[model samples]
Target: MMFKTDKQTLTDLNVLDWNSASLLRFFDHTLTLGGRDQLYNYLMHPLTTIEEIVERQETIAYLSTVNVSKLFDKYMMVDLERYLNKPAAPSVKNRTSYFLDTISFNFFSLSAQREQLLVRQSVREIAMLFTALQDIVAEAKSSGKAVGLLRIYADFFSANASVFDKEEMRQVGRGKSWRLTTHKYNYLFRGKRRPQVQELFNMIYTLDALTAVAKMWNEGGLCFPRVNTNDTAAALLRIEGLYNLALDNPVKNDIHIPSAQNIWFLTGANMTGKSTLLKSIGICIHLAHVGFPVPAQSMETILFKGLMTSINLLDNIGSGYSHFYAEVMRLKTMGEIMTVDNPVVIMLDEIFKGTNYQDAYEATLNFINSISGIESSLFFVSTHITDLGEIVGMDSCVALKHLETKADPKQGAIFTYKLLDGIATEKLGMWFLNRESVFETFRAVQPRKSSS
Candidate 1:
C-alpha cells in the first residue's frame, strides 16, 4: 500500500516545498534531475516494513562514507529522455552521402547539431555512470563489507558494463573523433538504445540521491533511528537530544514514551517553543520512516503505519467553514483513521483553539480521552489548556509535558524552550500586553481638542 499521508500532513511537517524552508529542500543536494525525482519519490512513499527500512538505512550508512567521485558537473544532466526516445535521425551514411550532406545538409544542420549534442551528453553520462558503478562494486568487494543495496546496484552495473565498454561506444562517449564515424553514430543513436539511456540516467540519479543524503547525514551529525518491528504487544517512541534541523541554534529535547503512554499533552505560554518541539518530533518521525538519518543524538520507535497532523490549520472562507468547524473536521478525519488497526502518529498543536475556551476545553478533553486508549497510536498535542492537563494526566495513557518560561518584571518573559514534566500555569499574554503599553497607548490619545 502507498504510504498513508495527506497534503496537510506534509505541510504541517514542513516536508516538501520548493520555495520555502522545507525538510525536502533542507536535504535536497541532488546533482541531476533524475536524482531529484528519485529523492522525491522516496520521500513521498516511506517504507512500511522494517526489513525494507533497514535495507535502506544500511545502504545510506555505507554509502555515506564511500568517497564516490562526482558523477557529473552541477546540473549537467538535462531532460534527455525526449531526445533519446525519439526515432533515430537519418544520418550521412556512406562517403557519397557524406559528400552530398556537406553541400546540402545546411537545412537540417541546426537540428542535427542539437541532436548530436544531446546524444554526446547521453553517451558521456552513461559511460561515467558505468565507470562509477564498477568502482563502487570493486570497493565493496575489496572492503568485504556486507552491503545489501549497494551490492545489488554494483551487480546491476556489472551486468550492463559491457554496454559502455564497446570499442565504438567508448571512443564516441569519450569524445574521440571516432564519434563522427557514420557506423559508430548509428550504433549509439539506435532506437534500441533508448531503454539503456533511460536506465543509465536512473542509475546516475540513484548515485546522486545517495550522495545528497550522505551530505546531509554528515553535515547534521545525524544518526540512524532504531526501528522496532517485533510482533510483541508493546509500543515505544523515544528520542534523545532531538533538535529541529531548520534552526540555526536549536535546543535539544528528549522524548520518552513507554508502551503505556500515547498522548503527550504540551502546555506552555506563547512563544515558549512548543510548536517548534512538536515540529522537531514530527520531522524526526518522518525522516525515520523514510530511512534517512535524523537530526537527533539517537532515536528509537515502533514502526508506525502512518502519520497525521492537525497543526497550522486554517479556515476555508470560500467553503463557508469557520475555523472551529475546520478544526472539527480535522479531528473527525483523524477519528476515522483511528479505526484502522495500523499504528499511526498524530500531532495537534493548540488543539481546539478555533472555539471558545469552554467548548475547546471540553472538545479537547473528550478527544484526548477517546484517543488515549488507542494503544496502536501515538500523539503529541500542545495547548494553552492547563486545567485539562490535570484531568488528562490522570489517564495512564497520557503524559503531560510543558515548556517552562522565566518572567522578569523588567525583562518580560524569557523562554527557555526546555521541555519539562507537568503543565505550565504561566499566562504571560497580559504581561506582554502591559509591556507593550497597550492600555497606556489608549490613555495617551489626546482628547480631540483641535476638533472641539
Candidate 2:
C-alpha cells in the first residue's frame, strides 16, 4: 500500500515537465512573503514538478495582511526613489531631473527631515526680502503643501524671468519654495530681492542644460524578468522511456545538463529532435537569462545579452541578392551584433544548406570558426552532414552531442530522441526508406557480378 501510494504520487508529479518539476527551490525567501502568489509561481516552477502554481489564488490572497500592505507601500516608495536614481525609459536628462523632483515630494510628505529642508530656507529668505508681504510665503511654507507652493513661485519667476537667469527666476528654481522670510524679519534689513536669490537662480539655470542627459532615462530600453541563480527552476519539456514525447513507463528523472561551456553540435538521424533539442535549449536559455522561470523542472544558466536564431533565414527578394548572398548577409549581421558588453547567444540550424556539399561544409566551418572565439557567445548548429562534428570538434571550440533512434517492432522505426554524446547512432531516413519495399527491385539487382 505504501509503495502504491508513492507510485501514485510520482505519477501525479510526472504530469509536469521534468524541467518544470525540478525548480522546487526558489521560493524559500522572506522577501517572497509580500508578492506571495506571484513569487510562488515564479519560484515553484523552477524547483519542483508543479505546473498549476497559478491556480493557487487562495494561497496568495491569504498572505496579504495589514502588515504586508504596509510593507508593500514601503516597497513602492523605495522603488520610486530607486527608479529616479537608476536608468529607465525615455532616457532624457531634464525628464530625469523632473523625476527626481517628483520623488522628492514622496520624501517630503513622508519625512519631517525632507519637509523642513524643502521649504524652510526659501520661506525665510522670501519673508525677509518682502517684509510687508512676508505672511504669504510663510503660510505657504508652514502648510504641508510645499511642492505646490514651489510651483507657484516657479510660475511667478517665469513671468519676470528676463535674460533667463534673472534673480527672481533663479531663486524660485534653486531655493524653490525655501527662500522666504517674514515681514517682521525683513523690516529690520533692507534690500532689492537679495543677492542670494541671484545665486539660487544661477543654480537652477543649469537644470535645463542637463535636459539632454535626463532623456536617456525616459527612453526605455529592453525590460526582462530577473531569475535567481540559487533558485530551483522547471523544464519546459522532457521525454522519458522516451521518444521526443516520452513513454508510458520510463526512467523518471530530472536530468540536469551540467556546466556545459562550449556550443553543442547536435547530429542525429533524419527525424530525431536534434533540431527540437536545439530549439528547446534556445528558448529555455532565453527565458531563463531574462529572469523568467523556464518551462523546465529546473535550470541554472548564465545570463547573456540576447538569443539569436539563423533558423528562419528568408531569401532576399532581389536587390540583386542570391540565396547564398542573403544567408551570408544574415550571418554577417548576427556576427556584427555581438560586441564587448552586449554579447549574443546564437542558434544556427545549419551553417550552409543552400550550396553544394563541399562548399556548404566549408562555409559551415568558417562561420563556426569566426564566431567561436568570443567567451560570451554560444552557437548550436544541427546537421545531417556526417563530417561536421569532426570538422568543428577538431578545433576544440565545439562540443558534440547526438540523438538515438530505435526500431520498435510494434511502433516500427521510433526515434528515442535522447541527447547522447558522440556522433548520431543511425542514419534514420535512409534506413527506413530502404525497408519500405519501395527499393525492393534496386536491392534485388544488387550489382549482379560486374558486367564483364
Best by TM-score: 1
Candidate 2: list runs displaced more than 4 Å: 1-260, 318-321, 408-412, 435-452
Decoy 1 TM-score against native: 0.87
Each model's backbone clash number = 0, 76
Error of 1 at 25 (Å): 2.4
User: What would the per-residue lDDT of candidate 1 be over residues 60-80, giving only the tens digit for each residue?
Assistant: 777777776467444556645
Q: Which candidate comes out best when scored by lDDT?
A: 1
Model 2: per-residue Cα lDDT at residue 299: 44
Query: Any idea what lDDT model 1 has?
Result: 0.77
